[model samples]
Each structure stands twice: as C-alpha cells, then as structure tokens.
Target: MAEQLRLVVPLHGEQVSNMQQLVSVMLVDDEIMALNNLKNLIDWEEAGYTIVASETNPRNALESFHKYRPQIVLVDIMMPVMNGLELSREIFALNIPVRILILTSYKDFLYAKEAVEIGISNYLVKHEINEESLILELGKLKYEIQNTETNDRYLRQRLIRHLIGGLLPPENLEIGIKNKYLDFKIGSLAFLFAKIDTSYPILKEISVVAKSHSNFIWDIFNLANDTEYMDAIRLNPDEAVFVIYFKEEELKETVREIASKTCKKMQERFQQDYEHTISIVPIIVDNKNQNIRNIYSIAENSFNYSVYMGKNIIIDYESIPTAVNSSFKEVSVILNELESDFVKRDSESLKNRLNIIFTLLGKPPWNPEDVQNTCDRLVFTLVKFRNKNSIQDNPSKIEISNLFNLNSIRKWFESEFISSVENAVTIDALRYSRIVRKILVILHHEYNVDLSIEEIADRIHLSAVYIRKRFKNEIGITILGYLTKIRMEKAIELLSTGEYKVFEVAELVGYSSSQYFSKVFKKYSGLRPLDYTSGV
Candidate 1:
C-alpha cells in the first residue's frame, strides 16, 4: 500500500476538562506495525493531546508535517529516503516551534549526541519505550506549550482591555502592532457582542458558559483569519465581545456580511451542541472617527434592544434609532386608564390596556431603564388595587429586575399580577352578599350529594327565586350553572387520582347517570371521561 496519513480531531460536544487544552501531535515511523504500536501506546485525548496525523513514510511525514504544522512530532531514527535526524533538521530550519522525539533501537551515544545537536526533544530506545516514559516526555512539552500560550493570552487580553478603555497610549499601540500582538491594519472595524438568551440547568455558572462560548468563537474567527484579524474577549459572566479588523477600508459591506455569517455559525453550533440560544449585536465603527471606547459603548447599548427584537437574533447598531423619547406624560395617562379598568373588574379591557402599554414601551427611542420604571409603576397600581379590595392572595414573587425583555415582563404581568387582581375582584363582588355566600358554601360542601336551588334556599331561610337571582347577580352565573362548575371540578380531581371509574366518579360528584356525566365532561373539558382518563 502507498504511504498513508490520517488526521483526527475532537468530536463535537465531547466533555473536556477546563484545564486540558488539547495539544496537536504527529507520528512518523517507517514500519506500519511500529506506527500502530505508538498510536496505541496511550490514550492521546485523555493525556491532553490529540494525534492529528500519522505517516508510515518519512518523506510523506515531512509533507504532512508542513501541511498540518503539529506542535509535537514523534519520529523513528531509521527511515527510508531520509533519516529521522535529517527530517528533524529540516523541521528546525523552518523556524517553527515544534518538539521532536526520536525512537530507535540504537543506544549509541554519538547518535544521541547528533540527535541533540539537531534540537530533538527526546531520544527513546525502541526496546525501552513504554507508556510511562513516553507520557513523561510529552507532559514536559505540554507544560511548556501551555505556559507560553497562557502568557500570550494574558498579554493579548490586557492590551485589548486597555484599547477598549481608551487607556492604551499611541506608542504602546504601535509597539503592540509591531510585535504582531494586535495585527490591526488601516481599515474598517466592527464590534460583535454575544450574550446567552437563557440560563440552562446543565451550565450552572454563567462565567463557565461564557468562557466556553469565547473559546468557541475564537476558534471560528481564527479559522477565518485570512480575510480579517478577530480578537475575542469575555466581557462578563454572560457576554463576550469580538473586535474585527479589516485590511481594506472599501470592505465595509464585506465586514457586515462576514460578521453576520460568523455570528450565525456561532448561534447554530451552540444551539445544536449545547442547547443554548445566544443573541448577537454587530456594530460597525464610524470610519471618520474610530474611537474604540465609543464603539464598544455603542455595541453594549445596541444589545439592550434584544428585549424587543427577541433572543437568537442579530441586531445591527445602525438600525437602532438614537432619538430620545422620554415622555412620561403619555405613560401616566395609560396607567390611569389601566387603574380604571382594574377597579371596574373588566378583565378583557385591563388586558388590552396593559398590552397597549407594552407596545408603546417596546418601541424605539425609549431607555430600558425608563421602560422598567414604567412597569414597576403598573405593578404598584395593581398591588394597591388588590389591597383596597382586601384580597388576601399574595402577589407573585417574580423580581422585576430579573425579567430581561418586554415579552417576559408582559407574561409576568398577565400570569402573576393581573390574574391575581381579577380573582380578588371576583371575591370582592361575592363577599358582600350573604345569600350568595351561603349558596356557595352549600354548593362546595354538598357537591357530592344531590343539590337543588330550593333545597339550598330552605337551609338558608330564603325564597328559591330570590336566592337564584342574587347568586346569579353576584357570581355572574346561575345557581345551577355554579353547582355544575363545582361538580365538574370535583369530578376532575377524583378522576386524576385514577382510583375511581367513570360510573363511580359520577356518583361521587353528584351525577347519578354516567352517560349524563360523560356528556357534561365533554362539554366542559372538550374530552370524554374515558379519553381524559387515558391521557392521565
């Protein structure tokens, strides 16, 4: 068979420890059996390294080495066409930082000396080679590589922070550019900010998820480094920002397209692999005056629009309107209408009025803080309405600050605040009428037994006609209608226990006929008793 080379990489969603950044490795041996032995010597991935490629021919190994640029290379001393020492010399002459290990059966000191002269990292006699010795050598090399990477990363992050804070002097920036740390050119630039849309149970800490997100984005942009230089940094526990530097000023539209595609890819991969939804905002820096601090500020401000535009979306900075519309007078008028609707106990009108408020606040030119304050005021009004009516149900414990967007806020108001207020209003209407109260008590207590308006009126010492009219007027339902509601609710509770059959539940909830109960259950719950039980 011809010389073979194979490449491998980490599979997607593989769990890797935070301390283990994978180091790439290549193996070159003339003997196919020796190559197989070396590959099986250790679990490369478990040891914090990956066997990216293996070649059986020295010449082919050299070509693959140049193509892959692996950080570490393991080669046999005896090879056809070119010896391992000659290949090491060629690799060293290329001026790349690569560690080379020599494997051979010869224990001659002169060969070892020659290998050392060629800058080989270690020389292992094939007879003495085992997993322990090989791992010891690879461990040292991995430590050195990690130290170098850590230092470079710290320096790069410091420089980026200084640049964004407007603290980097011109001279220092020039030095950074010269050292290839910045790699910026005279051209257009953009800032892309990404934030997680929801907190997942698996990722407990925001900082851990943010760091992973940053690393993932860095890998993607680094792959596209041929067209632009991208620098990514984690801004906080929940957000990461990227600075994109273009080589040509005329590539303005290209910058937008590239940024959009990069963000789209990040969104897709994170969602697919981790079940996360991230929102990204890309802000193109003003070419006439490229102030790093101002550009970053604009990018952050633009991210707030995710509340209205929604999660897993891309919002361009230019698309946001800058005009300030801080008029609270209109908001006060709407609040007054909302209070009126609440006091009148008109649930539909109250919901419509609340929706109108969200619509007006959700529009552009309004500060998010102002919108939050307006929502707080609406909550306060509802709370006051509940207290005035003496409704004892506590307001929902949802924190307004934790609600990130207008949609979530609207849901909180409807499910937590408005629903409680409507229930309180219904109770207030029923509390003043003794006849209605007595009728309700009888219906709730005697729901299992056969009940009638005349029977309830006789127990309460009132006329059947007066009791029916009063209960209907106070509760907005006829006496028979209310009894049926209570009986149906009790039937559902009993059926949910799975301890009673349809005929048995009919007797337990005041329905003498199972067929009549089934007909009534279908009308109330849109399912026959048997169908509902099957689902349960």
Candidate 2:
C-alpha cells in the first residue's frame, strides 16, 4: 500500500487549489515496517501534502531529501549508522528552511530537549503517534511554511526593487545577502531589460496579458543556461527588468550568448503563442565600481534605442555607436522636398522622399526626441498643405504624436497620411480610371460573397490579368488582399457589437471554415475573435 500510495501521489509544486499548493513530505526510517506504517498512517493527499520519497536507510534518505527538497521530513530518532539527529545537523548546515519531526520511542525529558536544541520542529512518541496527532502536527508545520514563504517572497520583491532603483545601501545589501533574501555572490552582474513593443496597434488590450508575459520571461532568464543567479522585477505594466549574476568575470561572452538564446526563445514563444512581439536589451556592465542604478540606467538607455532598431531583437549596449549627430538642417531640406512632392500630387515621389527621411532618422546618433520633433515637423507640413488645398481628410495630431517607433511611424506616413492625401487628390481620368471604381464598388458592397478576381474581371468584360495589374497599380494592394482587409474590418465591427459568435462572424466575413477564420483573425488583429468580443 505504501509503494502504491507513493506512485499515485502528486508531485511537489502541483496545485491543490486556486490559492494553495501541495506541501511535500519525505519519510526517513531505518525500519521498513515503520516507514510503511508512517506512509499508511493517514491520507496525505486529503491533508494537502504529498509523500515524495520514503527511505529505510538514513544515508539514502539524505540523498533523496536533497533531490526532492521536501518541506517536511519525518525521521526516526534511533537509527543505526548515522542517527536522526546527525542527519538533521547535516540538513541544517545547508541553511534551507525545512521542518524536521523526530519519531522516537524515548519518553525522557533529556531526549526532547536535545531534539529541540537541534531545531527539530516537533517529536512524536512512536507508540503514541495516531493518525489524528500526526495530522495536527503537520497542520502547524504547513501553516508556518506558508507564512515563511509569503514573507520571503515579499522581502525578495522589495529588495529587488531597491536594487533596481539604486536605493539599496551597502549595509542593506550586506544584510540581504546574509539573510538569503538576495542571491548575489562575489560575481559579475549584468541586467536584461525587456518590454513589449508599444507600437502594436492594440497596446491597451495587450496590457491585460503583460503580467503573464512578465512571469514567463522571468522564468526564461532565471533558468538561463550558465547563469549562476537571476532575479526579475516588473518595472511597469509594459516593461520588466532582470539582474543576472555570474560567478566568474570571464563569462562576459557567455552572458551575451545566453542572452541571445533566451531572447530568441522569447520571440519564438511569444509569436507562436500570443501572436505578439517584444524587445530585449542586454547590458553587460564591465565596471564593478558602478552601482546597480548605473547599470539599470545603461540598460534603460539601450532599450530606448529599440525605436530605431525595430522589434523582436536583442539590442546589445556595447554595440551602440557613441557618436552623436545633430543635423536638423539636413532634415529640414528633406521635409521641404517632401512638401513639394505632396503639392505636386506625385504619390510615388512622396513615398521615395519619406523613405529617405526615415532611413536617415534610423541611422545612429539620433535620439527619440529628435525623431519625434522631425515627425512633428513633417506632420505640420502635410497638415498645412491639406488646409491650404481645402482637403478635408487629414491624420489627427493625436494619431501622429502617438507613434512609438520608426516602423510604426513609417507605416502611419504611408497608410494614414499619404493614403488620405492620395484619396483627396483630384482624380485624373488616367489614374483613378472607371474600371477600378467599378471594382471598388463591387468589393465594398458584395464583400461577403465568394467573388474571385477572375469572376469580377469576367463580370466587367476585362481579362483577369489586366484587371489584377490595374488594381495593384492603383490601390497599392492586390484585389484579394484588399478584400481580406475589408472583411476583417467588417468582422471587427461585428464582433465589437457583441452580437455575433465566432462562427457567425467567420461566415459574415466570407470565410467557409471558422477555424481558418480564427487563425487569420488572430494574425490580422493579434487577437482571436472571441478575445475581441470579450474585450481581452
């Protein structure tokens, strides 16, 4: 029965309830019958505890104890070849918190005194150990362990905050190290700052999953290969910071390699699971004289460069250029030329000029503020041209200012700003020809129908090849691509009303398979149709 029970027990760290985790127990006795009796003494799982290991030899018990690291150990006091007290001494020397209950036959006061002096939690006289008595004792130990864990977690979080904020004093650091709250050694320290890319369209919705992402990323870095110790703290809803301690100074390159691998894993997991991306900046502080604040500041500064470097990559601090460029006059010249292109209604020239400006801005030595100011100036120039030309449609100031990165800014310039300008331009018969207008009408009105490019071309008495080329040239996207975009937009509207199920939305969006529709929806919007409806 003891062997069978051990086989069926839940492993340590398994969840017992939403708010409670199973406490693990290890049984150590020199007698096989006594060990089996202890295992069968009570229903351990019912009491929220699991018997991970049971041993008849004290030496094997010590080995199993280290391997399982159970919170509670029940050992017989009168064991041969390394008695229970000697084993307890060895366990205590490891400095890990564990409750030891001595099972003894002795009734002497001296025996109990020795057990207490050796940090034994409680002793159960072997003959008097009933199921009720054992359960009561285990209850007290579980409560104490839970309290200690809660306090330890709180202290660890507080200390990490202090370290990151540069407020931890030398004395506090000493005390934290001594008390085992901070897991730092005489080793080289570095930091990895991670943040979800803010330029994602549904950032507000993404914030709902930020805490879970933070925990997942923390686990990734904490379990990083070759890392001696790691601790992480969430700096905000969108960002987290991790401090990694390496035991050897020569592992600097090892740190970068591990960080790179970790970041790649993070990218793969996030993209595959969440359909999202994140930016990680790894900073290795070479100067031991600097404090934690200086190290964090360096990582933070490196993280800011993600705007130029783009998303889903590791930005190494040492790789950044040290030189600064302040060529606002050259940027002004490009802005003036962009305004000329806009006035000429040359959409192609406008695209080329915007690309030049963004490419120049992406080069090193420009700060975010410099980019922002340049972007603001460009918005002003376009808005001025629109106002002078009496064009009603223009990108709002808020939309222009809210762009967070170079990629997002460039996308906005093309899609929102330039597209609006193109639409407002006086339609030349040679440009926005009658054939494209008819196709646009068909797409907007009959989007839910199974209309293919060939069928539409046949309906309009044109060849499919000619229409496909004409559509792409005029609309900047293929007919099918535009159709998908329209369908997805309509689906969003339908889902926002909270009146349609996913399948219904799928059908209304011209998709035959709801499963395929969901996949496409997630890829298009970074959320499932259900998540959008549920406001997640």
Q: Which of the numbered candidates is closest to the native, going by highest TM-score?
A: 2
Candidate 2 matches the true fold with a TM-score of: 0.56
Off by over 4 Å in 1: 1-151, 165-183, 186-188, 198-229, 248-250, 285-289, 363-370, 390-408, 426-431, 434-536
Q: For candidate 2, list the clashing residue pairs, or say none.
A: none
- 267-385 per-residue lDDT for model 2 (tens digits): 66666655667788777655655566776788778776767777677887787764375766566667755754564456787788888888887777766656766767776666666
Q: TM-scores, in order shown? A: 0.48, 0.56
lDDT of 2 at 56: 82
Report the C-alpha displacement of residue 52, candidate 1, in angstroms.
Answer: 19
* Model 1 residue-pair collision total: 0
Alpha-carbon lDDT, every model: 0.70, 0.71
Stretches of candidate 2 exceeding 4 Å from the true structure: 1-20, 169-179, 183-196, 200-234, 240-291, 308-333, 343-345, 360-374, 383-405, 415-536
TM-score result, candidate 1 = 0.48
